[model samples]
Target: MNVSQTMETEEDFLTRLHIKLYHPQQSCKGLYGMLPLGKRSSHPADVPLRLGRDAQACTYALVDPRVSRKQLALHAYRTAQSPDMLFTIQNLSQRGRLSVNSSALGYLERMDLPDKALLRFGEYEMLITRESGEAMGSFEVEFEVLEMPPSRETCMCVPSVTPVMELRALVPLENDETLCHL
Candidate 1:
């Protein structure tokens, strides 16, 4: 080898997403055996990460009423300075905004995804992590369709941003209630 020539020390790696959902509203309980709370799954970066209330359309489904049928999607790309993956998140919700790391993303709005992000929407919180390794060459979710574990609340209760909010001055009646987005 010539001393003037520089050898590449970094190996190319495929992008991967590690997604885990939290704050399961009662409506999402039916997803118990299908989409359990805190079940982390790794997905190939080549594929877009989709999430919403529809099981058939969304890659990760949540049945919460406050959630939109097609909530959001994430697409991955590469940069000159990094080998891992960079992502951009698009909000697809018709009724609410997606809060990424405390920043609000309205419908059809797109934002550059950080390596790690805290996504909040409709009483649901999702923690997305970036993972890259030479061994992750295939485009597949880490787990099978039916491998979700039992439903449980593994996350702590904290004030989080939701797409919609309604705070009444007096006790709200079942019939006299109005929803206001904050």
Candidate 2:
């Protein structure tokens, strides 16, 4: 189901955000088991942030709420396998309009705004701002559904034997090279 259908109120919106941030399984089908943390920007000048695994190389530019009238951009970097994708969700709360523009994908024009705005594309997660607050409100912004690589292992075997037989095997052998013959 689309987020609009499932999410109706501020509380529901917050709950969905929590689930998308913390519990992946309950949010979407393909994203349930994927990595949720990624490398975050460390520049002191940048807004303090935390990232999920799926957000590698993604950059978020926060417009000062005081300066800008109403717009935010999430500058996301694409991986080598996939072209750079910028998934933008514009929310004009005063006019009550929301739109999504993606670089890899086409545009989702002028979707009517409900109460909040959320956009999810592949591993990318984004939530646009609607109102200012004392403490910055956070939302899971990027998610990448990556298939974990397979792992390998090695094994060795030892036989069960009586202590006497084992002692006999351990005795000094005529030829050192023949010690493994037992």
Candidate 3:
């Protein structure tokens, strides 16, 4: 099949684009998840999704009473320098304070959000991260802390000749008779 003959769906095109919203606050644990952009509208008015408490008025809803029905908006803008869509968040709530990376935004104000940016609406917090092209990769790390052995001597000035038991590493021997030689 010719490349031009292949019809691309909105979901297929969106796979190339890495855009999502996630909640990462301690107060609201397990609320953390990614909300991916699935489609785009041809009409200009149809674009830009709104999020809030009310079920009908928002694309993404927050059930908390402290959140307004129309809390914020997620809009996309393209620039001459890059072909990828850039996103900016607009604050629409009257009572709810919107913040980007801990900086408060004025009412009806908009701010550019970068990848891995922290967004806060009152106590609700969300993280916006986009991984595109070759930069998309994840890794895991493990760490352990080793504790020191307790000493019999309490005074800091005095040095004890007694060896600390916990500081030694025990080696395994296959035969029990070999232990007496050491």
Q: Give the count of colliding residue pairs in each prediction.
A: 0, 9, 0
Tell me the tens digit of each residue's lDDT in model 1 across 1-182.
Answer: 77646554223344456666555344443643445344445566577778787778887776565678889998777777765556799999978878887689988999998866767776566666666644333332332221221122222122334222323333244432112212
Q: Write the per-residue lDDT of candidate 3 for residues 21-82, one digit (tens) a residue.
A: 43334336323222223543221322666777776877656556667889988676666877
Arrange candidates, best TM-score first: 1, 3, 2
Over 4 Å off, model 2: 1-45, 48-55, 59-115, 118-133, 136-182
Superposition TM-score, candidate 3 onto the true structure: 0.52
After superposition, candidate 1 runs with Cα above 4 Å error: 1-14, 24-28, 36-44, 134-182
Candidate 2, residue 169: how far the Cα is off, in Å = 91
Residue 167 of model 1: what lDDT? 33
Model 2: colliding residue pairs: 36-52, 36-53, 37-52, 37-53, 38-52, 38-53, 123-143, 125-141, 125-142
What is the lDDT for 91 in model 3?
93
Using lDDT as the measure, which candidate wins? 1
lDDT of 2 by residue, 66-166 (tens): 21233223322223663222222333233323223222223323333222333433223343323211121222333333232000000001123445578
